[model samples]
Target: MNLKLEPGTLDDAAHLAELRALAMRPSLERVGRFDAERARQRLLQNFTAEYTRLIKQDGLLAGFLVLRPQDKDLLLDHFYLHPDFQQRGLGSATMELVLAEADTLGKIIHVGALRDSDANRFYLRHGFVLREVAEFDNYYLRYPQHVPLRGV
Candidate 1:
């Protein structure tokens, strides 16, 4: 499958908000925090075209990703794939790109997953180390892995 990350636009907010609601519903519901309106509003409030990307699979919109650069770290803020796209390796492939960007910038990556969400395992598998357990969320960090000089 051909995958690409295309820059997002302000006009894409509404559509993306709906996508976020759909993508997060299961985990949110599992935690008893499912509020479609709240999910959409939260995403809309922080939507940044500069940091957002529309994930395309074979020329169709499959999901969205939001990676923001903080002082010395990068935040994996919002990553959502359509229900149909889940468990299809697209998320992993998208993560590889995100991680590569973090590696290139030598920045630590931060992400949070809802308590009991499958995403927690996904993050851990991709080298994220659990650092904090909040009331409803689990935070993780991934430090950049630098290659050592052959002779030093």
Candidate 2:
């Protein structure tokens, strides 16, 4: 699959919000938090076109990613792949790019996955260490892999 991340825009918010709701439905329902309106509203409230990216696969919208730089680390606020695109390595590919960007910036990456969701495993597999476990989410942190100096 030809996966690419394109810059997002304000106009994409509504569509992305719907996508988020759809993509997160299973996990949300499993945790008894599946309110469609709430899910969409939550994303819309903090949506930032500047930091969002539309995940497209060979010209079709497959998902979205939202990475925001924070004081000491980068926050991976949103990452969702359509059910059709899940388990096909697209998420991992997208994560590789995200991790590379974090490494280049020398910043740690922080992300939170829904409690008991498969995303927890995905993040852990990507080198994110479990940092905290909350009521409904598990937070993780992945430190950038810095290259050693040739001569010091």
Clash number for every model?
Answer: 0, 0
Tens digits of per-residue lDDT, candidate 2, 1-152, equal 79899999999999999999999999999988899999999999988999999999999999999999889889999999988889999999999999988988899999999997899999999999999999899999999998565588
- Worst 10-residue lDDT window, candidate 1: 143-152
Query: Could you tell me every candidate's TM-score relative to the true structure?
Result: 0.95, 0.95
TM-score of 2: 0.95
Q: List candidate 1 segments past 4 Å from native.
A: 147-152
Clash pairs for candidate 1: none
> Mind giving the per-residue lDDT tens digits that candidate 1 earns over 1-152?
79999999999999999999999999999888999999999999988999999999999999999999888799999999999999999999999999888887889999999988999999999999999999999999999989455589
Model 1, residue 64: C-alpha shift (Å): 0.6
| Candidate lDDT values, in order | 0.94, 0.94
